[model samples]
Target: MDESGSAASVDVVLPCLNERGALPWVLSRLPQGYRAIVADNGSTDGSAELAAELGAMVVREGTRGFGSAAHAGLRAATADYVAFCDCDGSMDPAQLPTLLAPILSGTADLVLGSRQPRRGSWPVHARIANVWLAWRLRRLTGGKITDLGPMRAARREGLVSLRLQDRRSGYPLEMFLAAHRHGWRIAELPITYFPRTGKSKITGTIRGTITALRDMSAQLRSARHLCRGGAAPSVRDTEEEA
Candidate 1:
């Protein structure tokens, strides 16, 4: 619902740290007719202020993980469709149109931008990790989610119904698994995966990579429990039944 008395079209929520340098380029490239929300994770580098200056809704969610900040941004989204992408300029905002089209057309409840490996772009370890995690997700949730982290779009109601609870690095996997369990239609669209310009606080650091792997393993376990316990329907099960 919006002030115009019509359903909001789409809202893009980007979780940002101290990415002021990259924010402008990303913001400038966003498609028309979509509002941007920048969830600041306790950044003191004027990121929030800069987002406000750029006319994006700046929300401060302190002491939160990337997932927590993303959840906050989703909660603040007021559109019929909600999309999220990183602020590191690695993912091009122009790719959003194809990802969002399926949701807008009533074909998919959740849409994930599959991070197609670019030539000489991503590091070798990241590619290996992504493949391993995607396989794990398929084994645990029967969802066949190809990309754990990418620019994603989904219906607001479907996303809200998932009640995504992971507040740490595991959020993206949790979201895909939840959607699977709820019988929500999910689809993947190929997108360019570029190496980010700024420092990657998550992947570039040793500690962060270890934490991410742990969180990913935890998500697989959680997904198994949820699907087997009749608490939710795995995406594959739902699709097959339909």
Candidate 2:
């Protein structure tokens, strides 16, 4: 049992790039009884070493994509439930229980931590983009999803069955769409969002936003095609799962 007097049953996966400055803060705030997995995407700032020193299992992935790193972390997770949180300091690791509660109570399969942005936490342009994308998602899936924030949790088996294929920014969208298609129960809870410690790789610049938009647009199109009775692509487990 941990400080909370509960046995650890969740693996919290942090898909990190060069988040050395933010990782320590995030790790320190994590609630008790949760295993931390730092999925390092070629961070040159010794992020992996820091995570290991902090007692997190560090898994290094050479592929430089958010989805790739996230998937790798999920594959390495051994818990019955897995949670994803950004290591960029914007998300609070202490609030993880909010995402995990619904899943553990059999009320939801996936629980997203919707950003209740603190003052100055979000840029105007990014907030507008997120609102539009979330609107599109609600329309496409007929679900009450509000934000596609990075902080989320789901059952390990249910997530794996989605066979998510996006290796870029579209990964989160693909997960939602595929989960909806597969009849997985999804929910969201509001969480505090703070300013990040360093520059964001995505949503920090016009070019990054455009690239992310392109990738997610393609994913939305593919989801539409699949919904229209198109053949499903072959699903394969990651090497870790194999």
TM-score of each: 0.88, 0.91
Question: Runs in model 1 with CA error above 4 Å?
Answer: 1-8, 230-242
Tens digits of per-residue lDDT, candidate 2, 127-231, equal: 998999899888888889889988999989888888788777878888888888889898989999999998888789776687678767877777777878997
Error of 2 at 235 (Å): 13
Q: Residues 1-242, candidate 1, lDDT per residue (tens digit)?
A: 23444444788989998898888988987887778899887776898899999989987876457777888899898887899999888899888888887777778888999887667667778778998888877777567677776589988777887887666677788788778777888888888887676777676778668767767677776677776774533322111110
Name the runs in model 2 displaced over 4 angstroms: 1-8, 232-242
TM-score, cand. 1: 0.88
Candidate 1 has an lDDT of 0.78
